[model samples]
Target chain A: MILAIDVGGTKLAAGLVTPDGHVLETRVAATPQDADAERLWKALEELIAPMPEAEGVGVGCGGPMIWPDGRVSPLNIPGWRDFPLRERLAASFPGRTVRVHNDAVCLAAAEHWLGAGRGHANMLGMVVSTGVGGGLVLGGRLVNGGTGNAGHIGHVVVEPGGPLCGCGGRGCLEAVARGPALVAWAQEQGWSPGHGPLDGGPYEEGRAVTGRGLASDALRGDPVARAAMARAGRALGLAIASATHLCDLDVVTVGGGLSQAGAPLFGPLEEALRAHARMDFARRLRVVPAALGQSAGLVGAAALILAGDRYWDAI
Target chain B: MILAIDVGGTKLAAGLVTPDGHVLETRVAATPQDADAERLWKALEELIAPMPEAEGVGVGCGGPMIWPDGRVSPLNIPGWRDFPLRERLAASFPGRTVRVHNDAVCLAAAEHWLGAGRGHANMLGMVVSTGVGGGLVLGGRLVNGGTGNAGHIGHVVVEPGGPLCGCGGRGCLEAVARGPALVAWAQEQGWSPGHGPLDGGPYEEGRAVTGRGLASDALRGDPVARAAMARAGRALGLAIASATHLCDLDVVTVGGGLSQAGAPLFGPLEEALRAHARMDFARRLRVVPAALGQSAGLVGAAALILAGDRYWDAI
Candidate 1:
């Protein structure tokens, strides 16, 4: 069995997974964003301590990580600047093998092994949650570029002249179609979220806010919500289409709360992709929902440890 | 000795290169665009007839090729639609090895083996000629995606809202910065070719349309020509920056006729890349002119054939 841990901005998940892809046990805890490295270590140890015997441990983290040093410096988590995560995990679970990779990359591994992308040779697995992130599995191998940051499809330019992205680029796919941006865009258009004359109803505060509210509204004949969703879908399709063209992925699996909007997103996304892609090969690429859910990161991390030698052997 | 052949829309170049990297002999011929498969075979045979004994033959042609099938359909050459190049080469040069690859991909291999990318682990080789094209060397291996169409970076979206590309996409990097597009842009702006407003005389046709003309005009301080060249440079740079972010290339070795424009293109190209790539990691990427000149295609194609077994084993 492998102990898998997923470290996100909001939460931490620890799972004990078996060789045949079974999650024997799992735990979840809210992450203490302000905590120092030591505090985070203690939190992780607590979760690992209670788990049954495992052969190894694996970690999946956010962006800007150093694989050689096993250190991380995620923008969302302020305290982890140059944090030595591998050493901490080693200390916490002595005598156990440990490996680390990006969360999206891990998710892609999981999908390739057991989810929607099973048996697919070239695939891109994406999570469109708080911020967009993804992993690429090409020719049945995970694509971690020089810095282990290959699949930053979120940063792919959607609108070169559009809104400013958090990475300081203009009109990234993340900036225009991510959850928070969707809410902000709705608010900018005077669609009140339980606030004023423009208030259609109580809308959530993320892109999911628009997705959940808009899907029903569109179904019930609300033009504004339908238009908003259509815009998001088109932008998503454009970005996905570009990625498909560039990477030659056979399939793209999308996950996250925002993707739960289902056909509201996938329908127009497909249409927009068809409009943008160049050849028949690119146009035939498939876009599907991620089969693995909240536990995908955990499963992927565990896979990293289980397939450690081979994983490292690949570029 | 290795025989290298580079086939383009208008020209066919064949060379007898020694194992030590010297071109001992060469043959240049105008392409037979209207030829059938048999005639095309005859042309290749005619070119190779004058060359010294060769160990292998390497071919570089336009893409969307099926390598395993040994066939190609070049867009620029109408008669080459699904041409069985590999079969013909194998039949004609029986017992001698023959391998074919996309021209830009071959150029990338050339640079990696003996040119600007000699010491790099990750490199992107680009060709800016009548059309823009690209080749990738990632993790020290040329990436020929499932269909041998991996590095079609020219089709990558650069200006999301710019021009209509021949590929049916709007604002592809190729559509905006390709040679014909640059000339078209200059003509649309009424920028007549010459050393000055009236001194250098009336605009000529084919000669003035070359990269050399652009360089001469830029040297002569022609504002409109300089602007057009700068625009092309900036577009190319932006695309390279985005590619750097995506693939983490150590160097970008540029070849092709337009790259011969030299510093006039490189200066503005570097400036635009640095300005657009907002991140530190993304900004550290380097862009340099290809060192292998025109022979890169032959060398790269030879490398592909030589590394065939190893390449197949990797993926």
Candidate 2:
């Protein structure tokens, strides 16, 4: 068994996953606000207390956190600069091994081992949730760049004159298709968003106003929602097409809340992909819905610890 | 000795390269116009006639070409769709071994074996000439994607709101910083471009106007040229940063005509890279100039054959 922890800004999830893709048990908790080292350590212990025995611990977090040093400073979490996440996990688990990777990268590993991208040697797993992120597994190994941030697909630009991204770049794939940005785009188009803009309400109280909401509205024949989803699909298709062109990837597995809308998103995405992909081989690149869903991160983290040094280096 | 052939849109270069990085003899010829199966075969024969005896043939060409089928259809070289380039070479040299790959991929191989990226396990070789292109060498082996197009970095978007590219994408790295695009951007800024736009006179020949030209003008205090070079550098930096973020490459070797500008481009490129790169390990990634210059393709082609089957799946 392996202990897998998925750390996010809003919540924390930890699980014990067996070798055969089974989730033995999971623990969940609200992520403490301004999680300093002490608070985070407590939260981690609370989540790991009831887990089954493990060989090691695997951590999945936001951003390209440090690998060799085992520190992390996720943008979404305040006061986390150089947080010793790996050290903390090692201390918590004692003598076993511990490995950490970006949440998206773990997602890719999970997808490759047990999800939509199973059996594919080169796969890209994209998470189209509140924010856009992804992981890449090429030549049967995970891709972990120098900063351990190899799969930051959200930052890639899809439109030259579309919208401004959080990274200060204009028209990045994130800026165009991320949930908040999608809602913002709808507002800019003179449409009233069902959940208002992401900026309003209590900071943590605001709900995601894209995807499912848009899907419902489209079902009700709301033209704006239909158009918004279409726009999101087009942007996503363009970004995926670009990835296909550059990496020659075999499969793209898309997941997260946005994917719950199913064909409403994939339909237009496929059409847009057909429109944008230039070469014959690129046209043949596969795009599929993710299988493991929310459990992907936890399972992937387990996989990281189980695979050991050779696989970790490949990653 | 190994026979190396660099096949391009307008020219073909053949060389006899020994194991120790020596080019014993070289041959060059214009690529046949309106090339058919027979014409291309005849042209290859003419180019190879004067070269020294070789044990095997290695070829580098513009791609999205298929390795499994040995077919080629480069963007600039029309009428080559599904053409069996390797079969022809095999037929000509019956007892000799033959291998083929994307030109940029070959460059990466050359960089690993004999150039600036030598000794690195994970490397990227970028060609910033007529169009931006690249190849990857990971774990000291080449990374050939599904159809030998794994390193087509030119299509990656540096600025989501920049310009149009020949591949029909907006704001691709190629659109903002390739030789022709750099000159076009300079002209659009109201500068009297020494090189004409893509369709005007001899300057329209496309590949001639590189970042080096802008660097020369920058040295002369030409504001537009200075800005053009800056943009090119930033674009290149973003691309490298993204590659580092995703590939965990330790070294990046830049080649082609534009890379000749040296520090004028490198300085700003480094600055832009610093801004986008992940903090940890970002500082460790090194960007260097290619040492092999024009001979990279030929040298890399030979290296491709040397590396053998472990990397065959990638190309």
What ranges in model 2 sit over 4 Å off?
Answer: A79-81, A91-95, A159-164, A184-221, A306-311, B34-36, B49-53, B76-81, B91-96, B157-171, B175-245, B248-251, B261-287, B309-315
- TM-score for chain A, prediction 2: 0.90
Task: Estimate, for each residue in A226-279, the C-alpha lDDT of model 1 and write its tens digit.
Answer: 566677788888877777766666888988756766676778888888877876
Pairs that collide, model 2 = A145-B248, A146-B248, A149-B245, A150-B245, A150-B246, A160-B160, A160-B161, B144-B314
lDDT of 1 by residue, B80-132 (tens): 77888988878777898778878877888888878898878777888887778
Q: What is the DockQ of candidate 1?
A: 0.48
**Cα-lDDT of candidate 2:** 0.75
lDDT, residue A306, candidate 2: 71
